[model samples]
Each structure stands twice: as structure tokens, then as C-alpha cells.
Target: MSTPTRKPLDRHALWSLLSEKSDFWTEVNVVGVTGSTNADLAEAARHGAEEGRVLIAEEQSSGRGRLDRRWTSPARAGLTMSFLLRPTAPRETWGTLSLLTAVALEETLKAVCGLSAKLKWPNDVLLDGRKVCGILAQAEGGAVVMGAGLNVSLTEDELPVPEATSLLLAGATALDREVIAAEFLAHVGAVYQSWNERGPASVIERWQRNSATLGRHVAVSFPNGRSLSGRAVGIDADGRLQVAPDGAGAVETVAAGDVVHLRPRD
Candidate 1:
């Protein structure tokens, strides 16, 4: 057997297909390499970049995840991109941006790649309990920039961590970045438009249906140095995770944290 060749995304094709799929996206920008798509989009948002502008990079030198942790992948090994949004929905609903994005990713992987993806609360998409995608949302002025990195063609030896997996590793034969990216954004536009028009209840419902974290024992470490171990009960209206702590503590609502699913004791 030989290594499969990874193809570069077709900028024109993605722009055309995404436009036909949804009128929500304004433009698509594909770069060979970038420091960070999220950083690029956030700066654009500050300078009045209109909503629906997308920035995608074939490789990221300074990619980042939540808590500013470094994220990196070989050139063309994955789909790394950022999308800009300035929704007219109530400001309170904005927190659902990452959740909605994760939901869209789950839908896209299933629809386009025939893979059943599950959402891990906050901003992760898991396959076989391994992370295949990570999402990060940054607020810039009145706009929001959401970035997602989906491992596509990385092999076992190329994985960043033992806990990470990719589409190829998950048995996906079709690894077209353009199709995956387009399908994902199309889903994003649909969910986002629905959230703005029909409110976030529907989006939240979809997220809950695809979630793997809810109802599971989890340990969350907050930025403030506090931690909670509990069963994830629900997602609050503000997009925080509501957890029923072990023992006898009030259900804790997590705004931001690193979550690790804990196995139940035998």
C-alpha cells in the first residue's frame, strides 16, 4: 500500500458551491499558509469586515485552541478556517456560536462523509471518542469570528496526540477538503440563519441531540483555577454547561474550561 495523495482545496470551486448552497457567506479566502485564521478574521472584523467572510489556510504556523494552546498540522493535512458573523440575534444568543458551529460540523461529517460525529460540549467534535475537530470562537467588537480545524488526511504517525483522530483514521475514504469545508459552512449558514430567525432554542435542541458530553461524568478545569467533577446535565440558555456535581453541591454552570470525560468507577 502507498500513501494517498492529499489534494489542495480549490478556492473557486468552494466559493461557487458554498454560494449556491447558502446565501449567508459573503466571500471565501483560501491561503497557502497563515499564522492563524482566527486572528486574521478577528482583525478583519475590527476593521468592519462584513459578516459571512471566511478565511481558510492550508497550514497554520501559529494556530491556537482554547486557552491559547498551540494547534498545528502538516500542510494540507486538515481543514483549518475561520468564519465571520455579525448576527442580528439578541446579544445573549451570541454565546451559542461555537455550539452551533460544532453542530454544523457533526451534520457535515455525517452528510458528506458518512461518518457519525458527536459534539463534545463547548467546542469539540469527536469520532470514536477521539477528537477530530476543535472550534474556537472569539468576539471582536460587535462581530464574532469562529475558527474550526478538522483533521482530514493525517495518518497515525502524523497525529498530534494519542487522543486525536482524523477522518482518514476514522475510515473515511472520501477526503476532499473542498467538499468538507463547503458542506460544513453550508450547515453553519443554515443553523446560523435559523438561530437568528427562529431563535436559539432549535439550534440548542439539535446540539443536544448530537452531544456526547451531556449525561456523562466529566471533569472541568476553569481558567480561574477552580475545578468541578460532575455529570453534565444540560446546557444553559447562555450556552454554559450545567453540571450536577458529585456529592452534594449546587449544579455548577461552566462558562469556560478544559473538559475531560471521566469513566465511571466499576
Candidate 2:
């Protein structure tokens, strides 16, 4: 797809743009907060927030990522939101939800912003091989909340980490956050419904199509301080990373890790 060329949109304009989309009028709450949208959404869910409810924040003081890593938020430079979902499946299948979300996000970026994005394993979105978005999925009670942050207009100076990037830096301009949000909600809702009915195999198939990690040499680091370097074979049925060492016949299933796709050894 061609890179998007548009100007950054303001908050009010974002809401207006989303208002024109279908199914976006339901229980969507936009907040101008000094803290975290994920935390707020978790609290809302604990208080019995309805499924499909969305919480969006303009700025976050304590934004978070997977494994409790700190996520940076610059005023209005990115999209920060959390979606509530109540699926009927067993909780054991929750790991697949993140991969499903990644596919949904990839579709949204391609469809709405005219920019192609790829999934970097578990949940990060990469634009031209730089991190542009992150997804954090958490299960609480009977509901699952998926939080996402997409760098929309952030410049290099605004990036919290050197490995991060934004749509603007990736050659996308005039991509309105609200338009992107609306499109994301629509697509994610559809994907979630499909997952509820057909299970995660189909979603995993879609994820593999957009994945950039498969077939690449990678370094996988575990929380226990062990690390392994191997080639990413694919994702198994449960959304675990399947990796294999050189000349090894057995592939290892990695349930959780920090996966860094490595450059091929020369």
C-alpha cells in the first residue's frame, strides 16, 4: 500500500470522524486523563462495565505494557485505548486473543490509513521494521481487556525509546486518530466475534500472514533469565512461538518471551 499523507488531527476532530462510522456510537468513552487508560478501564471492568465498551485517553501519566514495562505518552501524539470483551470461551484460550488483536490492528492500519503494518510476534506492530504500536491483553473475571497504543504523529524527539517510531516517521501523514480508532473498533469487533464462534485457529492463520517474525533468526528471553537463539519456525495452535535451533529436529514452544528478530549471521 502507498504511505498515508495527511496532517495530524485534533481530539475533537477525531471524535467527529469516528462518529460518522457505523457501530461507533455505542458506549464509547473518551477521556482527557493525566494517568492510564488501561488502569481506568480495568477499574471500569471491575465495576461491571458492559462488554464492547471502550475507554480512550488523550494523555497517560502511567501507561503500561506487557510484563509491567512503562509505556510513554506524549500529549496527543498517539492513540491510547482499551476495549472490553466478554467471550464465552474457556480462559485457557486467552493467549490467542493477543494474536487475533494484532491481525485486527494490521487490517485497520492497512484499510484506514493506507499504510501496511506487520505484527511483531505476540503483539507489537512494526512499520518498516520499527515499533509503531503495542498491544496488552489482560483477563479479569469473565471479561478480557485489550489495550493498545499506536504512535500516530510522534516525532523522534517524542519517542520514549530509540526502538520506537510513529506513522508520521513511517511516511504516513494526515492519518486521523479517530478515523483509525473507528476502523479498528469495527474490524476488531468482527474479528472477535469470529473468534468467539470459530475459535483461534482462523485468527492465527490471519496473524501468520501479517507476521514479520516467522522464518527469522531470533533471540528469545524468558522472565526466568534464560535466553535462547533460534530461527522462528511459526506460531503453534495456541499462539506460542515455535523455534528451532540449527540442526535440531525438535522445535521448542515458547509461551512467553521477549522476542528479538536477529540479523542473519554472515
Per-candidate alpha-carbon RMSD to the true structure:
1.2, 3.5
Q: State the displacement of the C-alpha of residue 131, model 1, in Å, after optimal TM-score superposition.
A: 0.3
Once fitted onto the true fold, the runs of candidate 1 whose alpha carbons sit more than 4 angstroms away are none
Off by over 4 Å in 2: 1-25, 247-249
Q: What does the lDDT come to for candidate 1?
A: 0.91
Clashing residue pairs in candidate 2 are 6-173, 6-174, 7-174
lDDT of 1 by residue, 110-148 (tens): 888889999998999999999999999999889999999
Which candidate has the top score in lDDT? Answer: 1
Clashes of 2: 3
Model 2 lDDT, full chain set: 0.82
RMSD of 1: 1.2
Residue-level lDDT tens digits of model 2 in 1-266: 33334333455665565566545335677777648777777788899987888888777889889889999867677888898888887677788989987898898888777789889898999999999999998888888889999998787877889889888888774467877887887778888888888889899999999889999999999999998888999988889999996665688999999999899871
